[model samples]
Target chain A: MNLQLLAFMILSLVTLGAAFKVITARFITHAALYLALSFVGVAGLFLLLNADFLAAVQLLVYVGAITTMLIFAVMLSQVEEIRQGAAEEGFWRRILSARFGVIPLAVAAALAGVILYLYRFANWKAVPVAPDPNTTRSIGQAMFTTYLIPFEVASLVLLVAMIGAIVLTMKKEDRSR
Target chain B: MIPLFYVLVVSTLLFALGVYGALLSTNAIRILMSIEMILNAVNLNLVGFGRYITPSDPRGQIFAIFVMTVAAAEAAVGLAIILVIARRYGAAAIDRVRMLKG
Candidate 1:
C-alpha cells in the first residue's frame, strides 16, 4: 500500500515480464533487450534490499556488459540460418509453443508451488530489522579484509576465462597456405 | 518493515522462470541468458538474506559480487565457444553441437 510496496510490486512485475519476454521473444536481439530490462529491474530490487553496491554492479555488469555482449554474439552468429532451423522445428513456434513449452510450464508451476509451501511452513531464521544504512562501506571493508582470498580467486577465475575465451575463438584460417 | 518473505518469493519465482527457460531453450545463447537469470535469482536471494539475517556484516553482498564476476567469466567463455560452434556448423542450436560427443 505504501511507496516501498508499490515499487516492489512494479519492479517485480517489470522484471518478471521482461524475463518472460526474454524466453518468448521472436528475435534474439529483442530477447537480449528484454534481458537487459530484467536486469535493470533486478538492480532496483537490489536497491530495495539496501545493497547499493550490488545494484551498481548489476547495472554495470549485467545490464551494461552482459547484455551488450549477448547482442553482439547474437548479431555475429548470423541468425538467418537460425530462423530457418527454427522454422523447421515446426509450426508451433509462437510465444508459447506447445511442442516446447508445456513441460516447462508444468515444471515452473510445480517449482513455485513447492517453494512457496516450504517457505511458508519452514521455521525461518531471518529476523526482520531495519536495514543497516552503511551497506556500501561495510561491503567494501569485508571484501578486502575478510574475504580477500575469495576475491583474489574470483579475479583469477576471470583471468582464466579470458584466456579460455581467446583460445576457443582463435581459429587461424588455413588461407595462410 | 518490508517483509523478507516477499523478496524471497520474487527471487524464487525468478529462479523457477530461469530453470524453465534454460531447460526449454534450444538456442545456445538463449540458454546462457537463462543461466544468467538463474544467477541473478541466486544473487537476489543472497542480498535479501544478507539484509535480513546479518545486516551488520556484508558477507552476502560480497558473495553476490563474486557471483557476478564468475558470471561475466562464464558469459565470455560460453559466447566464445558458441561463436566457434556456430561458425563451424552455421547454426546455433545446441542439439547440433555434437563434435565432442562420442
Candidate 2:
C-alpha cells in the first residue's frame, strides 16, 4: 500500500478502535478518555483529507474542550455507582439479559441495514485528492462573505447554550422561594 | 488513493455503533458519548463529500466546523442537565429517572 492508503488505514483503525472501546468500557472515565483518543484519530483522518483547518478545530474543540467537560461532569456528578467502580449491572453487565439487549441490537441492526442499502445503491462518483494551497483562504473568504450570517448565528447558538446550561443547573427552589 | 466507499462504510459502521449505544446504554453519560460518536460520523461524511466534490472550495469544511461548534454546545448543555439529573434523582441510569416518564 502507498503511504496515503497506509495512513488512512492506521488512522481509521485507531478511530474505530477507540470508538468501540468508548461503548464497551467498564468505567465512565475510561469511556471519556477513549472518546478523546477517538476524536484525535478522527483529526488525523481530517489531516489526510487535507482539511488542516478542520483538523485543528477538531483537536481544539472535540479532543480538548468537550472531553475535559465530560471528565468534569463525570467528576462533579460523582454518581455512587461509578465512584466505587460499579459493583455490577452496568450496561455491559446487563447485555446478557435478553430483555435489555434485544432492543438495542434490533435498533442497530435496522440502522446498519438501511445505511448499507443506501451505500450500495447511491451512485456516488467523486474521488478526492490532495488540497491546493488556497483551499483554506477561500473558505475563510466565504465564511466572512456568503456565510457571514450563518457564522454569526452559530456564535449566537453558543451563547444561548451557555445561558441554558447555567439555568438548567440552577437550584430548583432558588427561584420558587 | 483511498476509495470513498471505504470511508463511507466506516462512517456507517460508526453511526450504527452510536445508535446501538444510545439506545441500549443505561447510563446517561454513555448515551451522550454515543451521541457525540454519531455527530463525528456526520462530520466525516461532510468532510469526505467536500473534499471530493469541491476541492477548490471548502464549503464542506465550513459546514463541518459548524457541526463541531454545535456539538460542543450540545455537550455543554447535555452534561449540565445530566449533572442536575444525577444530583436530584440520585440516579445516573436513564431508566430510573421517572419524573417526566409521562
Candidate 3:
C-alpha cells in the first residue's frame, strides 16, 4: 500500500474509534475528550484531502474552541453526576431496557447500507490531478470576492448566537424588565 | 492517490455512528455532540469531493466553512439552552426535562 492510503486508513480508524467512544464512554467528560480526538482525526483527514485551510480551521474551531466549550458546559451542568460518577446501569442492561434493544443501531446500519449501495450505481466524475497547494490564499480571496455576502451572513449568525447565549444564560435578577 | 470511494465510506460510517448516538443517548449534550459528528462527516465528504472532483473550484471547501460556522453557532446556542434546562431542572438528560411537553 502507498503511504497516502496507509495514512488514510490509520486516520479513519482513529476517527471512527474515537467517535464510537464519544457515545459509549461512561464518563461524560471523557466522552467530550474523545469527541475532541475525533475532531483532530477529521482534521488530519482534511489535510490528506489537501484542504489545508479547513484542516487548520477544524483544529482551531473544533479542538480549541468547541471542545473547551463542551467541557466547560459539562462541568457547569454535571457537577453532581461528575462528583458521584456516572455509575449508571450496566451497558447491556441499559440497552436491553431502552425503548428498543438494538433498533437505533439497526436503523443507522440500514441507512448507511442504502447510501453505500446507491453510491455503487452513481458514477462520479473524478479527476486525478494535483490540487492547488495554496488553499488558504484561495479561500481568503473567495471569501472577500465571490462569497462576501455569505461571509457577512455567517458573521451575523455568529453575533446572533453570542447575544442569544448571553441572554439565555443570564441570571434572572439581571433582567432589566 | 486515495480513491474517493474510501473517503465516502468513512464519512458514511461516521454519519451512521452519529445517527445511532443521537438515537440512543438520553443526555442532551451527548445528542448535541452526535450532531456535531454528523456535521463533521458532511464536511469530510465535501472536502473529499472537492479534492478529487473539482480541484479547481473551491466551492466545496467554502461550503464546508459555512457548515463549520453554523455548527459553532449551533453549539453555542444549544449549550446555552442546555444550561438553562440543567439549572431549572437540575439535570440535562432529555428524559428529566419534560416541562415543554404539549
**Candidate lDDT values, in order:** 0.84, 0.84, 0.88
**Whole-model alpha-carbon lDDT for candidate 2:** 0.84
Off by over 4 Å in 3: A82-88
TM-score of chain A, all candidates? 0.86, 0.86, 0.90
Best-performing candidate as measured by DockQ? 3
For model 2, what is the error of residue A127's alpha carbon versus the real structure, in angstroms, after optimal superposition?
A: 6.3
Better of 1 and 3 by TM-score: 3
Q: Residue by residue across A108-175, what tens digits does model 2's lDDT show?
A: 98988898898888897664455365666877999999999999999999999999999988876886
> lDDT by residue for model 3 over A1-177, one digit each (tens)?
399999999999999999999988888788899999999999999999889989999999999999999898787664465322245444456667646448887899999999999877879986767646588888899999999999999999999999999999998888976
How good is the docking of model 1, as DockQ? 0.68
DockQ in order: 0.68, 0.69, 0.72
C-alpha lDDT of residue A19 in model 3: 99
* Ranking of all candidate structures by their TM-score, best first: 3, 2, 1
Candidate with better lDDT, 2 vs 3: 3
* Deviation of model 1 at B30, angstroms: 0.8
List candidate 2 stretches off by more than 4 Å: A82-92, A127-131, A172-177
Q: What docking grade does candidate 1 earn?
A: medium
Winning model by lDDT: 3
User: What value of lDDT does candidate 3 attain over all alpha carbons?
Assistant: 0.88
